[model samples]
Target: MSSLAVRRISECFVKPQFSNQICNLTPWDIVMLSTNYIQKGLLFKKPATLIDEHHFIQNLLEKLKHSLSLTLFHFYPLSGRLVTHKTQNPPSYTVSIDCNNSDGARFIHATLDMTIADILSPFDVPPIVQSFFDHHKAVNHDGHTVPLLSIQVTELVDGVFIGCSMNHSVGDGTSYWNFFNTWSQIFQAQSQSENHEYDVPISRQPIHNRWFPHNCSPPISLPFKHHDEFIWRSETPLLRERFFHFSAESIAKLKAKANSESNTTKISAFQSLSALVWRSITRARSPPSDQKTTCRLAANNRSRMKPPVAEEYFGNCVHAVSAETTTGELLENGIGWAAWKLHVAVTDLNDRVVLEFLEGWLDSPFIIQMGRYFDPYSLLIGSSPRFNMYGCEFGMGKAVASRSGYANKFDGKVSSYPGREGGGSIDLEVCLSPQTMSALESDQEFMNAVTEFDPLLF
Candidate 1:
C-alpha cells in the first residue's frame, strides 16, 4: 500500500457546560486501576446526497462537539480525572472534576486522503489505521492532568472514522457503549433541530451508585514502580491483525456440532466461536504436544452480583475466567471439548464467587503479574457479541462498520462485536504474530468456516 499522510486541523479540550464535581471511585473501579484503557471506533460511508462536502463535514464536527457537551451533563465522570490520595490509609483515591483545569474530553479533527476501499480492499486492517489511535500518550502528564475520555475524528475521502478511548478504571464495555449510544442519541436529536431533547430523561440516565457486599473494606492501591512501561517484552515478534466474519448460519452449524457430542444442552454462539478460534490459534502456533495453553475470558459480573446490579449502573464489573488444557488434548479431541471448557468457566460464575473475589481484592490489591497482553502461550478475549455496536447512529445513518482501534497493539488478543445485520451473526478482530497469522490463513479447517468481512454482506 502507498504511504498516506494525515494533517491535524484542530485540537481543543471540551469541558462540561454544567457544574463540576468530584465522584468517588468505587471498588469496581479500583479493580481496573492498572489495566490499559479500552479503544472503540466506528466507520461510516459519506452521505450520497450531499452537494457540498466541506459544509457537510463542518456541520458534522460541530454537531458532535455540541452533543458531547450535553452528554457530559448526564455522564459527568467522563470529564473527570483520577486522583490518588497521598497520606490517607490504604491511599484512598477518587475521580475528581476540578474547575481550574482543562478538565474535559479531548476533541481532535484530522484529515486523511484515504478512502474506505483502501482499508477494506485487502480484507485486512491497514497499518495506517494505527495512527488513528492516541496510543495512550502522556496519560500521566505530571501525575495531575489525565483525561478519562478522548475522541478523534478522521475525515476520509469517501467516509468518516470516529475513534474513542475511555479509561477502564471508570467503566467496563457496557458502560462505555452506554455513553457512546447516548451521545449518538443526543447528536441525532441535534441533527433534526430538536435541541430541547439534549436533557436526557431521568429514566435513561446512568446510575452511579457503586454496589458492594456488606462489610466491604477499602481496596489498597497496588504499587508499580514503572507503570508507564509497556507490559509486553521488547523482543516480542512482529504481529499482524485480521478481521473474520461468521454468518448466522455458520454459527448455528457450529453450535450443532458442539452439542452433538453430548446430545444434551447446546453451547452458545460465544462458546462455539471461542472454541473454533482457540483451536485454530493453538494449531497455528504449533506448540509442543506436552505444553499447556490458556484462554482468558472477560466475564461480566453485573448479573452475577447478589440481587443483580441495574443495567445502567456504571463502572468496571468484569472478572477474568481462564480455561486451560494441553495442546495434545485440545487438538486430539474435537471442538466440542474446547467449547465445553469455555461453557464451564462462565457457568461457574455466581454471586458467592463474585463476592469472595471482591473481598479478596480489598484484603490484598496486588496487581497480579502474568504474561503480556499478547503472550504466545496465552490468549485473551475482550468484548462480547451482546454489545450492539452497529446500532450507534449519529443522524447521518448507522455505522457501516465498527471495530476496536487498539486490537493490533498486542498479539493473541481477540475482540468480538455484534454483526451489522443484527441476527445473531458475529465479527471477530484477531491479532497474532505475522508468522502465526500466515499459518492460520493457510489452515484449511480454520479457513473453511471463516469469511472475509464485507459490510454489504452483513
Candidate 2:
C-alpha cells in the first residue's frame, strides 16, 4: 500500500461507529470529508452576567447525579480493534466552574453579561482553562485514535460559564440536551429552597425491532453511522440568525400558506420557518445559468412519536427530513411551495419504516459504532424551540440566549418563548466557516431582507 493509503486507511478508524467506513482513502472519501466538514463555527453573542449564585452552581451538580452521572465510559482498545460497553451508561462529560476577580479603580465588581458574540470567541476564556477539556480527551484517548468524552467547567463570580469538548462519536444533540437540561435544572434547583423538577418517569422502554426496518441482519452496535460529506456547499453562501417578530396577520398568512392536508397534519411556526430557510439556502447557491441542487431539513422526534417522550428523557431523538429541488425551482416556487415540500418531508417522518429504524437504533448496544458510516454531507438543518434561557426557572434570572451544543456544524438550533426583556428575541448561536460567512454578510440585499421580515424595520 502507498503511504497515502496508510494515512487514509489508519485515520478511517477515527471512530469505531461505522463498520463500512472506507478501509482506505478513496476518491469518494476525499470529496465527502473536504466538502462537508470544511465549514467552521460562527460567533453568536448573548451577554449575561452571573449574580451571586455560588450555591446555585454547587447544588446543580449534586442533583445531576440523581438522574444522570458524569463518568468515563472506558472504550478498551484491544490490538487494533475497540470495544464499548453494551449499555446505556452515565455521561462521560464532567462540569466544573471558573472565575476571575478584576479589581482596578472602576468600583471593579460591576456585573458583565457575556453575549452570544463573547461565547464564540474562545479568547474571552483563556486557553489553559480551555485546555482542561484538551487534557480530558487527551488522557482518555490514551494514545489511541478513537473518540472519547472529557468535559471541563469554568465558574465566574458574577455567573457560571460552560465549556465542552466532547467526541462527536458518543452522541448528538438529543444526547447533549438530556445532559445539559439535567445540568441546567441542577443549577436551577439551587438559589431556591424547594426541590428541582426532573423529567417524568419512564413509562415504556421502546422495543428494538431490526427485522421490521430492514432485511434480517445482526443487531449493530452504538455509533452506527460514520460521518459522511456535507451533502451540499456553496463558495459564497452566507448564513446568519436575525430574530423575526411576525405580526398576527403575517403569521396567520404564513400559517395558511404553509397549511395543506398533505402537510404533516399541522404545519408549525418552526416548520414554516424551516421551509423559508430551505428556500433561502437552496437559492442562495444558484446553479450555473439554469441548474439547482437538492434541499433538506432536520426534525426532532421526541414528541413526534406516540407516547410522547417525557420532558426529561435524555438522548438523541431526532432524524433528518430531506427535500430535493433546484435553486431556481425552489425560490421560484416561492415560500408556500417550498413549505409544501418541507411538510411532505416532515410528514414522511411518521411512517412505520421510520419507527423501525429507530427501533434498531434504540436496541443497538453499540450505536456509536454504526454512525461511522452515516453520510456526512446530508443536510439536516434543525431547530429546538426548547432553547429557552429565561425558562430556566431553576433559580436566577433567565439566560441571555440558548443554542446548540456543537460549535461548528450545518445543523442549527433556535429557542423562543419569552425573555426578561419585554417581548425581546434572542440571537441563535451560529458557527459558520469564514469564507461562506464573509460571502453571506457581503450581500447587502440579504441584510436588508432580514429587516423586511421585521415589519418594525422602519
Candidate 3:
C-alpha cells in the first residue's frame, strides 16, 4: 500500500463519427478562451468481490474505450482541437474548433494501487491527492495549442477514478454533464450487451450555433487579448482546501430559516445553502466591519435565453452574478437577508439581461476584473445544485463521490456538487487561506451545519 503509484497503460484517440469541418466559437465561448478548463472527476468504491484483478481491469478498459468512441460519434466537437485564425480585416483572431479527426480526444489508461478509503477519508483533500489529475490538465498553455478535451481512467485497488478535462471555451457545465451522462448511458449499454439501446436521437444531440451579440448602441469588440494565466498563481498567502458535507436535513433547516423572513418569495435550497456558506465564510474571515465583501456565483443561462436555447446547446452558456455587501451587513442581516440578495440577483438574469451581458462582454472583455482568488473579500462559487453529479453511473456502480480537480488551487473558491446520497444534499469543496480555514474549523455555527461524510453510513 505504501508503494502505491500511477502507471500509464495505454494512450489512444477517440475520433468523432464525422470530421473535416470547422466550428466557430460563440461570443460566450470567446470570453472564456483565457479561463481555466473545467475538471469533473468521480471516485468509485471497489466492488465487494473480484474474481480476478487483471481480468476485471481489462474488461473495464475495453468497455470504457469502446463506449467513449461511440460517445464521440454524438459529441464530435470534444474530439476536435481548438485553433485560432487571424483575419486580415480588423486584425482580429477567431478561435474555432477544427474537427479534423486527426487530433481526436485523448484517452489515457492508468492504474494506481490506492484504496478509496485512503484518499476520501479525513475530509480535507491532501495536496498529493490532486496529483491524480496532474497528467491531463486542460489549460490553454500556448496561444492555441492543446487538445480540446482529455480523459483519464485510473484503476485503484478498491475502486476506479474517471476524470475528464474539457476546455471552457467549447463547453459549459450543462454540456459537461450532457457528455458525461450520455457517455455513462453508452458505457452501461455496452455492459448490458444486446438488452440496451444505443441510439441517441438527432433532436437530442447538441446544437452548436454560436450566440452572437444583437444590436447595441455601440458595436462590441469581436476578439480581445487576454492573458493566459490563472488568477491565484502569485498569491502571497498559503491556500488550504477542504470539503464540507451538508446533509439534506441540515439544508432543509437552513432553507426554512432563509424563507421565514420573506413572505412573498420562497428562497430555494441552493440560495439558502449558499447564503449560509457565504455568511459562515465571511464570519470566519473576520475582516474589518467596513470591508466590502462579495460572492460571485456562476449562473447558467441556457433556460434564461429568449425562447430558451435547445435542450442540448453546446458551448459556454454561463455568466457570473455577483452579490455584494459589507462584511458587517452580511453578518448582521442574517441568512435570510443574504439569501434574498442571492435569489434576486439570480432571478434578474432574464433573456434581456443575458443579451445585455453579451453586449457588455463585447464592449470590453476585460471590464470584469475577476481576480477574486487573491482578494480576501471575494468568494467565488462554482457549480450548481441541479446538476445530477452522483447519478453518473458508469457500469460498475454509482459513484461514491465526485469533485473538481481545479477547485483546490483557488483560494476562497467554493465548488458545489450533489451529495452522493442525494435528496437535495450538497458537498462543497471550499478553498481558503490557512488562517481563515482554521477559523472556520473552530466556528461552532458553521461546524454544526456540516455532517461528516461516510459511505458506509449510506
Tell me the TM-score of each prediction against the true structure: 0.91, 0.52, 0.91
Candidate 1 wrongly placed segments (more than 4 Å): 88-102, 135-144, 194-198, 217-237, 368-374, 456-458
Cα lDDT of model 3 by residue, 285-392, tens digit: 888989998987899887888778775888888888889999989998878999999999989889888887676666665422234333777788888767877767
lDDT of 2 at 246: 34
Residue-pair clashes per prediction, in order, are 0, 64, 1
Q: Write the per-residue lDDT of candidate 1 for residues 1-458, one digit (tens) a residue.
A: 46677767997778767646655555666545445567788988889898999999998998889888888778877787765444456443333333335458888898889988787767568877766755343222222356778888899888888988887767889999889888887777777765555465533678876665687633334443344432322332466888888888888888888878646475787898899889999999999988899888889898888798877888778888888999999899888889999888888989888888877866765442223344577788889889868878875588888766642246788888888887898888888888889998988877887755578432
Cα-lDDT of candidate 3: 0.74
RMSD of each: 3.0, 13.3, 3.2
Ranking by lDDT: 1, 3, 2
- Candidate scoring better on lDDT of 1 and 2: 1
